[model samples]
Target: MKFKFSIIFSFFLYITYGQINVKGKVVSKSNQPLEGAAVFFNSTTIATITDENGEYQLTVPEGKYKLVASYLGFKTVEREVDINENTSLDRLNFTLEEEDSLLNEVVIGAKKKTKSKKPKYEDFLVFKEAFLGRTNYAEKCKIDNQKALKYYFDPATNTFSVEAKEPIIIINRDLGYKITYNLEKFQIKDRIISYFGYSQYEELEGSKRKKKKWKKNRKKAYHGSLRHFLKTFITANTKEEGFDINIMHRVRNEKHPSDSELAFSKKIFEFQDKRSVPINFNKVIVKPESKLDSAILIHQRQLKHPKIIDKLIKRNVSYSDISYRVEGKVYLKFDGFLKVTYNNEPEEFNYKRDIKRRLGVQKSNFLLFDSPQEILPIGQIADQNNRLVEGYWSYELFANALPLNYKPPKE
Candidate 1:
């Protein structure tokens, strides 16, 4: 089974500058100042905690930003402001109301539920691996809050489902970023995982030496990433950027997917009295092999390596057309997997204790599916219609994500 991410909204982690200034105060609904409130732009490292008087100041580069203010026991607040060379923003105060944090119906036990109504321990383990990830950086990730998650398992169909009542806070010590994630939906069935969520990242404070090391690591993380590939594609620098695309086709499984593979979870009776606890999965029930030829669905099912045809020419691609966004047959979906070859290879160090590896990156090969039409802006590649292949893009998480504004350092 393959697992990958399909980003749906506009999420960015752009770098910030001090050319623009923004100041604000944080207060409660009663007009009482709230000190130590976390405030910052989404995704960027620029952020500040409120002072004793609930006042704060921030100077950033000229750009559009969603300023956020958050405090414990209060609803998070966000305001959008755009800064151009001609103007700057100031005195943007926020009044936060109390927030209601409720666990999912399962956690609060709003209705009667038995042990069988909850997710199995093994299924949950798989969910964690798919969501938090299986990489070294993911290993270093610690979820500050886990109890808020609501889980359910269906054994008859082997489907696991989960959703967070509140945001999931994670500290990525290896990557130097703290992420707050709000999960909207998640499902694991037939060894395949799919999820969509929103998130914000706050850069961790560190010493000068540690910050330097992190800078190197951040650059290393960007290589071969989807964002890296997109920027290069937009600029028509695929060869120089070390990227090659081979359009492969998917051959539909002659035998339609079994009931076990279909996304719908079969119901079960929890008690001897025949109390049926149906798994309430309110999503479109899709066959493991979705039959929409017009809209190609990306799944992680793997068969023996399949055939490849019509390898695209690097010279045929133009600066204006990057394939994923324009909607013709840019990608080929076969019923099976393709034999892939990446022009670039992962980096290998020859010497011990080499920080040089920190300064550079090795390339990785990836296979992902995209929607026939785009759900995001031109810069983003795939939408919900697309499925990420369980390779490089799936492996990389928010820990390594960068914004469209990022530019690789000149070698």
Candidate 2:
């Protein structure tokens, strides 16, 4: 699971107060000024370059952010900043150390020997789909550096993993943004995929008409999205934002036989049917040879009657139903699954066909892996790993991602 950094922006401060000025200096370990060092907040476009004096400044809204300073041939430095009414902005400074290039070279050399074999075409396809996702915008998104990716497959566990030697450059013509993604980790196992990365977006140059089209497309992508849902949910405006919330209870099927019972039954069937007799088995006592057979049988039964939502606990849920306040901080807590329905927009054709939902409404399922997730004022979950999502939200991946600083146009 990706670690989601939750940033709580002071919406009240943003609307009525002036921006905060953040000034900082970047110096080497030897106290030498580092010129042309890029200083910015991770995953946002709020950035500046250090001058000859290694001084950089930025005016930003009050919020919690991961500030980063990067220069070529030096290790990047990151600091967590909380800019509020009492923050002393001038204290924000960074001292970077030189990176060990020789160690890096040795590691790269060893990796090359072990992973010299080229990846199969089919493997690349799987990697692409899992990383880029299957949204409409993903169709127009292209990864510019395929060679930078290294692939490994473990047939024993049926796991596929990928790593990038450098930042992956992606050009999204539809959204009019060129993105640089620093992929940290990516893996696919047991039909579950997880990838963590930081992204920086640069606006693409285009004609006036083309720019207008991109703006419209970006807005379309933002609506009915997870971010939009979170913003509305925190503001207690789900209904106004065309969202309907419901509590769904998933129960295990009682009719499903236990693994031991299945194993006993399988032994009986094999003995009675005289199918594949064991080498040293007697008629009085028959035992399964390995766990693999039992696992396969259990999996087959689960497919027939998997754990399913048996009931709806409530409908038209309000924000208070799933949230609580402690010392002025908000946290979302709920039982079972959260069934979210977006009524304003109909389901896409691909989604409908693949998910096999005939209803035109857009519906998604939200499950809490870790309960009582903190909710920031900016509509971001403080801990991203705490929640698991399926359906519509799961379909929208990096292709539909927007910067944390993205703001919807005023209605």
Off by over 4 Å in 2: 1-17, 27-36, 51-54, 71-76, 97-121, 154-158, 265-303, 307-310, 326-328, 352-354
Judge candidate 2 at residue 197 and give its lDDT.
60
How do the residues 57-99 of candidate 1 rate in per-residue lDDT, one tens digit apiece?
A: 9877766666788776677777767666555455689999986
lDDT of 2 by residue, 1-411 (tens): 221221111111112135889998999999999999878776666778899999999988887877878776676677877787799899799999986654223233234213324456666677776777667888888999887777775555665677676678888888888887666667776777777665667788999999999888889888988778877756778788998999998786775767676777566656645766453222222343555354444545555675543578998898788987889677889998789998998877656545644858888877777888877665667666667777777777778777677777888
**Model 1: runs farther than 4 Å from truth?**
12-18, 29-32, 85-88, 91-95, 106-127, 144-169, 180-213, 249-342, 347-390, 402-407
> Against the true structure, what is each candidate's TM-score?
0.61, 0.79
Clashes in model 2: which pairs? none
- Give each model's whole-structure lDDT: 0.56, 0.72
What is the Å distance of residue 179 in model 2 from its true position? 1.8
lDDT of 1: 0.56
